[model samples]
Target: MTFTPVTPSDIAPGTTRFVQHEGAAFLVVRDGDGRVHALDGLCSHALLPLAGARVRRGHVICPHHGARFDITTGAAKGPPAHCGVSHYPAQEKDGMIELDLNP
Candidate 1:
C-alpha cells in the first residue's frame, strides 16, 4: 500500500476537508475522538461533492440532501444514499495525515 502524507494542520479536528491525490478525490475527516478517516469525496446519492461536510458521531453528513456515511466503513447510514462511498485506509503518523487512496 502506498500512503501519501498530508499536512496535519490542513484539517482541524471535528471537521472535513476535500483533497485530491493522483487523480482521485478524497475527504479527510477528523472526528470528535481525533481519529482520522479517508473517504471518497462525493456523495453516492447524487454524486455531489462532500467538501465542507459535517462530521458527527463518526459519520460524515452530506451537505446536500442529508445523506450520512460511516467514516470507517463507508456504509451509507441514511436516506438519499443507499450506496456507500469508498473508504480508504488512513492514519496519523509522524505528525502528518497519511492515506492510501489505492489501498
Candidate 2:
C-alpha cells in the first residue's frame, strides 16, 4: 500500500504529527533536512507514542523511557527500546511530501 501526505511545513522541522490510516495510527517524523519519513510512531518498548519523542542528536528520543530512534531508518539506538520501528519511504513532489508506507 502507499503512504499518504497529511502535513504541512508550519509544523516545524523536528515536529511530529500523528496520522490515522486504515484504522492504524502512524507517526510521521520530519527531520532537519526537510525530509518526511513515516514509522510505527509508537515505542516498541513501552508502547508509547513516538510522536512525543524529542528531536535531539539526530534521533527521536522517546519521552516515556528516553528511547532514541533514528528518524530516517527507525532503528533503535539504545536501551529501554530494543525493537526497531517500521519505516516508510518518502518523497517530495510539486512542493508536497508523500510517503510510501509499504516500504
Candidate 3:
C-alpha cells in the first residue's frame, strides 16, 4: 500500500491535527501515551470537522459535540455517533508519521 508522510513534530503528544492527503481530510492524533493514530477527519455524528478535537483516555472527543471515537479502531464510543469512521494504518518511519490511506 502507498503511504502519505506527515511531519512528526506537527502533532505533539496529547493533541489532534487536521490533515488533507490525496484529497481527503484526516485527523492525525498523538495520544497521551504517545501512540499515533489516523482517522477520518469528520465526526460521524454530524459530519463535523474534528481538526481541533480533544484526546482523552485513548479516545478522540469530537469538538462539535460530545461524541467520542476510539483512536485505535475508529469505533464510535459514545452517543450521537453510532457509526465509526475509517481508521487508517499509521506508523512512524524515518522521523515522520506515515499513513496508509488505502489500507
Candidate 4:
C-alpha cells in the first residue's frame, strides 16, 4: 500500500491538525491516549470543517450539527448523520504517522 507521511508521533494529545494531500483533506488528532487518528477533514453528514469539531470519546463530532462519527470504522454513530466518511488506512512507524489515501 502507498502511504504519505502526515505528522510526527511526538505531537501532544488534544491538538487537532489538518493535512491536505492529493486534493483530499485529513483531520489528524492525537487522542487522549497519544495514538493518532486521522479522518476526513469534512464532516460526512454536512460540509462542515471537521477541524473545528471536538474529538471526544474517540468520535469526531460534527462541529455544525453535532453528528458523531467513529474514527476507527468511519461510520456515522447517530441520526442526522446517515453518510459515512472515507477513511484511509493509517500506520505509525518510528515517530511518524502515515496515511494511505486513494483518489
TM-score of each: 0.89, 0.81, 0.91, 0.80
Q: Report model 1's TM-score to 2 decimal places.
A: 0.89
**C-alpha lDDT of residue 90 in model 3:** 92
**Model 1 residue 15 distance off true place after TM-score fit, in angstroms:** 0.9
What lDDT does candidate 4 reach at residue 72? 72
Assess candidate 3 and give its TM-score to the true structure. Answer: 0.91
C-alpha lDDT of candidate 2 relative to the true structure: 0.73
Q: Lowest-lDDT window of 10 residues in candidate 1? A: 4-13
Residue 88 displacement in candidate 4 (angstroms): 1.7
Better structure of 3 and 4 per TM-score: 3
List the candidate numbers ranked by TM-score, top first. 3, 1, 2, 4
Q: Among these predicted structures, which one has the highest lDDT?
A: 3
lDDT of 2 by residue, 35-57 (tens): 67777767888887765767776
Tell me model 3's lDDT, rounded to 2 decimals. Answer: 0.88
User: Which residue pairs collide, candidate 1?
Assistant: none
Tens-place lDDT per residue, model 3, 40-90, is 999999998898899998899998888999999999999889999999999
Model 3 — which ten-residue stretch has the worst lDDT? Answer: 3-12
Candidate 4 residue-wise lDDT, 1-103, digit = tens: 7779887766577666777777778887777887777788888776677867677787777778988888777788866789877777777887888987753
> Which residue pairs does candidate 3 place in steric collision?
none
Q: Among these predicted structures, which one has the highest TM-score?
A: 3
The superposed Cα distance between candidate 2 and the true structure at residue 32, in angstroms, equals 1.7
- What are the clashing pairs of model 2? none
